[model samples]
Target: MTLSVTPPGTSSGPRSGHRLAVRPTRRVVAPEVRRRRRVQLTWALMVLNVMTFFPGAPHLLPIPGSVGKLIAQGALVGALVMALSVNRPLRVRPSVYVVILMTLAVEALLSSLHAEFLLGALFRACRLFGFALVLWLLTPWWTRRDLLLVRTHLLMLWGIVASVVVGLAVAPGLAMTEDRLGGTLWPIPPTQVGHYSAVAIGLTIVLWMSGLLRRSVALVSVLVCVPVLLLTHTRTALVAVLAGVTLAGISLFTARSRVRKAFAIGLVVFTLGDLTLGSVVTTWLARGQDTAELGALTGRKAVWEAILAQPRSAMEVLFGFGLSNKSFNGLPIDSNWLGTYYDVGLVGCALTVMLVLFVLVAAWFRPQGPHRALALFLVAYCVVASFTESGLSEASPYLLELTLAASLVYSTPTREGPR
Candidate 1:
């Protein structure tokens, strides 16, 4: 006798024989559920990006250095991937700015051939490309602007808390120098901490002005960041913060009601007055003056002179000596523009300037609003900070924040009203 088995979800019967009946069920998820899931996933990714900067994360998690970098890079890549999967079909037409950025990346890679360490140069170039990709992917999330802003600030706040906690746990005394508060989570430089604190203050101001943050909370955040900023004692950071706050005030005053305008103007005047009259501020300025009067720029001027002294071929001058080339006679080139010129040459420098100018102009032309003001503030900070430190050169938390700001500025619709 031959016997046959029926497949699942199928029914079969012989004239008088017993038969099995089955039904198929489809598990349909509600659209709202899916949306919530995506939003949560995005928040998690943002947190991961921020946590990558925690000095203790890699060690605490027992992840290798290389693996940690890969994880960070993967998080960015994963965000892009998820966005592409859920969003409308990717557009074939590319933005002009993106094309220019791509060209610059290509130039950087080519210039890397002349670097002292080819692998290092390639790695740097790749990391930059990763950042560009991540930012580009963010352009599609303009519809979720509120969520994006909240997630970003939340992560930033977490970073601040983590830095303080880690600093206090390890080398608290070393973290804060005599008369200066430069506490940092290990692996984060004191200067970087200062820069972070400055930016945080600027962000808090904008958020509070926009009414996205409560006045009490904003005041508390500013108070918390100020001592850290003072401790860092980084002159460039101080200057950048001042420039950012001034720009923010101007932007707010221009776009707000008469009452708000008056407040904005008053705040600006107060900040300027404080910088001028505060004893500690004067002391900082005096220290800088003493260094400048000696023609050393606290050793930065000497580094620049050494770099300029090096004999270079026409090709090298036009296209740079390559990334990470140590032709500075054992001196560190502390300025981003100068470092770019040394690493990538005139062409690279021009590209960097164009990129910065484009972002600045874009932010300036944006309709008067808090987002526009914040973008302008960030761009101003980066521009001023670059003059003293190579803040824009590498893949760090600070650079990541700048990239996010630029992406937000570029992606935001010009006609949208203030949030």
Candidate 2:
């Protein structure tokens, strides 16, 4: 039938050889493998997103009787997602995750032995651990594009905050500051409000400097956020916001640009004016026996006084009595140094300090790219805010959200580190 002979290097039919010759074929990753990789990545991202939801904050989980139920539900959900991703090629490293676990350990040890709401604290700590895990999984190689994306994301965040601030300014009864500053979004405490606001403000400035927003819009939005600070009635928050703005100005400045210089000067003036006004109002509102006033200036002096009067032992110093009891009438221990010390004692406090140090170092050295200045400002604000607020604790969802946001923004890939 005179079949045509094929060329030597090409074959239209399969060949069998005693020599067991092998031929190269194009490598195609399995569709299932790709889908699984995508799922794993998505799960990791969801872990971070849920953590940012601030699941542990007071208002979000205010169930007094069924608190355990809520925690169990969260744990189960986390477990399910984790199990789904178990065989995926994703793993969390130690350095980025240890601090969170340590925090939980410290909380548990304190609660089991001394805290009033030990179970509550443990539940909250679990949420924080989840947050840390999400951060570790997502931040391995934040890039320049990532930094830009984070900056844009921060603008949206600030825009939301600014809108709330404007609402508070316009609404009378809606704006109230509690023992902590609580917001419409998070009715936990005033400190929580301030801490989150400060971080958002810092990020906004970064985005603005990166030209992520229209100058006119950014300018107007910033102005709107200012008056909202007044409504918060949080002297510390107002101060933190202004401080963040000023730092951003300094960072985004050049030797030129008269408007920029003017803005900087104006920010300084505004900050000082706010501080002066707050002090005046604080003084005017104080009655001679006003406990809040006494606590405001000196910061829980009464609480510390109560702690000092009570018994002291090496165990108490190292491992605190826990937050189960609010029995601070004996000594006036401040929440900053006192809370950890009172709950976990000296060793816990030391470890907490170490964790803070690590975060600070990571914040300082971590590449910030176009957002470096903003990241620094946010980190500084967080460090200062932590002193007055239970920032390290997962009890405040606002704080947790802001912390996660900050980590994401700072860790975003920039010419300056991993997302």
Strongest candidate by TM-score: 1
Cα lDDT tens digits for candidate 2, 319-389: 66654332364443435566656655676666656655555566556553345455556655655565554
Error of 1 at 121 (Å): 0.9
Model 2 regions more than 4 Å off: 1-88, 93-118, 141-144, 148-171, 174-191, 248-264, 267-299, 323-334, 362-369, 393-419
What's the count of clashing pairs in each model shown? 4, 46
Q: To one decimal, what is the Cα RMSD in angstroms of model 1 from the true structure? A: 9.1
- The lowest-lDDT stretch of 10 consecutive residues in candidate 2 is 46-55
Error of 1 at 199 (Å): 0.9
Question: TM-scores, in order shown?
Answer: 0.75, 0.63
- Cα lDDT of candidate 2 equals 0.50
Candidate 1 wrongly placed segments (more than 4 Å): 1-94, 142-154, 169-171, 177-186, 257-277, 285-295, 325-330, 393-399, 411-419
Spell out the clash pairs found in candidate 1. 180-231, 181-231, 181-232, 320-345
Candidate 1 lDDT over residue span 237-279, tens digit each: 8888889877876787745564286476767988988977788
Error (Å) of candidate 1 at residue 33 is: 8.0
